[model samples]
Target: MESETYRGYNVWGHAILQQEAILAPERFAASGTITRNNKLVEASGVLGLFNAEAEAEQAGLAWALAWIDSHG
Candidate 1:
């Protein structure tokens, strides 16, 4: 996870991984979490999934910024 400060909020990029079966495969996804004043304000939700970490981080940041604009 990487944290970025944006407009007084700390936005974190989170990677989500799920293993369907021991011999199957693992799936990857990502989302954003937001904190303000050291307290959690928002969690991982509404953010779209991506096949790559970079794409997910980019999308998560965009989503977080939009959320802040509307809800801040």
Candidate 2:
């Protein structure tokens, strides 16, 4: 998980590891959250699967920023 403040809102990016079988390559599930003043503003379901954790987290962050832009 990673956190950053944007436009007075706290944004969180998360990556969850997932594997279906022993031979399967590991993947990450991406999600995002937004908060203001310790209050929950929004959260996302799994955004997508990524081959790398960093990619997943970056996707989450991008989603959060886009959401903030559309809603703010």
Candidate 3:
């Protein structure tokens, strides 16, 4: 239900999840830039600067699915 790495915008890294596709595939190394959703929540830090479009989309969907499985 998940992978080790993901891509988004211009970044890539480990993908974390919450519940119900709330938070997108966000990879951040900083301590700021927070993100949230109805069920998923997290932050898109510096890691986002090295992700690919497909990786990000895949991670995003994966994150959402994980969220649904966990919180749904």
Highest-TM-score candidate:
2
Query: C-alpha displacement of 53 in model 3, angstroms?
Result: 0.7
Superposed on all Cα atoms, the candidates' RMSDs to the truth, in angstroms, are 2.2, 0.7, 14.1
Q: What lDDT tens digits, residue by residue, belong to model 3 across residues 24-70?
A: 65442221121233222443333332234455445544444444345
Which candidate would rank higher by lDDT, 2 or 3? Answer: 2
Sorted on TM-score, best first, the list reads 2, 1, 3
Task: Work out the TM-score per prediction.
Answer: 0.73, 0.95, 0.32
Tens-digit lDDT track of model 1 for 1-72: 667899999988776664569985554576888899999998867466566667677777777777888986
Worst 10 residues of 3 by lDDT: 3-12
* Residue-level lDDT tens digits of model 2 in 1-72: 888999999999999999999999999999999999999999999999999999999889999999999998
lDDT of each: 0.75, 0.95, 0.35
Give each model's clash number. Answer: 0, 0, 18
In TM-score terms, candidate 1 sits at 0.73
Q: Model 2 TM-score?
A: 0.95
The Cα error of candidate 2 at residue 51, in Å, is 0.4
Candidate 3: what lDDT? 0.35
